[model samples]
Target: MLASVGEIVVVRDGSGPEILLVHGGAGPRTTWGALAPLADRWTLAYVHRRGYPPSPPPQQRQDFEVDARDLAPLLAGRPHVVAHSYGVLGTLIAAAAAPGSVRSLTLIEPPLNYLVPDDPEVARLERIGDAALTHGMDMDPAELREFLRVAGAPIGDGPLPAGVVAGVRRAHGGRPTSEARPQLEAIRDVGVPVLVASGDHSAALERICDSLADALGGKRSVHPGAGHFVAAAPGFAEQLETFLHKSVR
Candidate 1:
């Protein structure tokens, strides 16, 4: 039987502590479902960001300001948490918001404002960044998702899944100008046992993860075969298990 989203504190029953799993843009809990095999050794809870997946929500520029504190009420307390990409943005915001609740965190590739590379030696890079940033603060949801996907990074020829691309339309526009600076500040202030990693291939990913690890007193792991998706790398589960085992005490 599956555990109820609200039944577990922090999220679900992991081997060491609780793990709250948050997904990136246009993704669903199924995004993490692939990792369910890890559930045998660890309790995992996958969050759908409320209105995402099959739910309906307002189209507005929202902030990760609420973090897991929004999930806290449901989880009862903060447990060890893990977030990826943009999901890490809010997870970090939450940890900073309610330090008492979280035990430890493993954040892989949280996108900070600076990760958006500005120097694109190639014209395509420049164009990608320009289109992605689009005034640096628009309320257009599609543009926002598109920017994140292509900004500072190569636009892979791979076609984005229709469901994934369509998911952006569900969100309210891009980052709010007033909120961006402060949000960045909050992530900078998070002082806790944390792990930050990125793929070796991503310039911005490597740079930002390094900066975050340095600032937050975190361990940096550069997955050799991975890029932005470090958590999906081979042996990531074992690495995480080792980290969690040591961290639980």
Candidate 2:
């Protein structure tokens, strides 16, 4: 059966403890591949954020708060949340706005820029992100390439993938409504079990992940050889499974 949270597509699979899997700019399919393995332990609810196909086009401007609002109702049961990239921003917001709405939070390289604003590496990333948001869908190819690189796309010498470019365009317009510091404070106060994970690559992302972990008083893990896409890294699923077991017990 098809279900939606305010026009955002929600796909569910398996039968077990509920786990909400929120995808980033890459959309729901980014989490689809993990369903089969996780389904044994988790009933997964994969969210297709607004602007992604099959979901409604973005409503007005695309603030992270908008995404958080869409997610609030879905967290009625305090499901465990595993979010990546931009999705992580929304998940944090929702968790903060509705205390106890999130049983546990597993963040995969969340781009919470405000977490480490003073870091030189983070400042460089802010410049790239600002450029992408400014250009929106009209971003030039060169700028897109750089943005993808800074955002941790594994794009090598080849041209940027059309799908990835499209996803970036879809997500580039909005600014975050709330800053990370306050959200972190709220989540910390709520006493949610938070786990911040990032790939060993991407210096900027690693730093942001570390700072966020510190702020939330959460555990931190760095996946070797994984760039921004830590979810797909080797042994990621196992590590996550272990964390889930330990966190809930």
Candidate 3:
């Protein structure tokens, strides 16, 4: 069923405990398709984030502050929150604002370069991401390819498909990751169970995840092979299930 909360379209599925699945730049299916089997044991509320179809486009550039506003209402009833990529910025903000309102948090490969500001490698990736999101369709082929690689876009990539092009267009002018500074202390202070996971493909990303894990006093896991899309990597679903079970309050 579709539920409209703060203009966000949530597609609910399965039954059992609830998990609010927030998609990032690539949209919901690409972000969480690998977790489909988990719906058998848990209710999954798939959120179509702003700028994606079904959900209205953002008023201006896609900003996490706007996303936090959209997501705040969905946190009601304390559903376990699982957000990927760009979506994690807003999730972290909302969770920090009202820590007790979330059952748990599982963040996968969030581009939280601010978490490791001193890491030049992380800074390099952040610059590339910012340029890609800001320029979007205007990006040159080489630059676009690099962005797709970092984003784990599933494409064999001869010529870009219309759908992929559209996705890129939607991401145009998105707020940069360098601007994301979620209140890690607030989440930590409230003792929210948090899991920060990343693919072992990029040492820079793993560094950011490691730093975020330390800041939030959370567990960290590396599920390699999927690059930025760690959710699709082998053993990810099982590990996520176990983490969710252990996080139950």
Candidate 1 backbone collisions, by pair: 13-43, 14-42, 14-43, 15-42, 60-172, 139-173
Q: Write the per-residue lDDT of candidate 2 for residues 1-249, one digit (tens) a residue.
A: 358777788888888888888887676665447445788768888888887767788877566777888899999987888999878888888888885777889998887777886788787676667667667657677766777876666577886677666656676767742244346788898688988988787788889889999999999988866567678788788888888887772
Q: After superposition, how far is residue 21 of candidate 2 from its true place, in Å?
A: 0.8
Candidate 3 ranges beyond 4 A from true positions: 155-157
Q: Against the true structure, whose lDDT is highest?
A: 3
- Ranking 2 against 3 by TM-score, winner: 3
Q: What is the lDDT of residue 41 in candidate 3?
A: 94
Candidate 1 at 64: error in angstroms?
1.6
Candidate 1 lDDT for residue 142:
54
| lDDT comparing candidate 3 with the true structure | 0.88
Per-residue accuracy of model 3 over 1-249 as CA lDDT, tens digit each: 888887779999899999999988888888899999998999999999887778888888899999999999999879999999899999999999999999999998898888777778888788888888878878677878777877887656598777778888888888887888999899999899999999988888889889989999999988988888788999999999999999988
By TM-score rank, best first, the candidates go 3, 2, 1
Cα-based lDDT at residue 96, candidate 1: 61
Per-prediction TM-score: 0.71, 0.90, 0.95
Provide the RMSD of all predictions against the true structure, rounded to 1 decimal: 5.4, 2.2, 1.4
lDDT of 2 at 87: 82
| Local distance difference test values of all predictions, in order | 0.55, 0.77, 0.88
lDDT of 1 at 159: 55
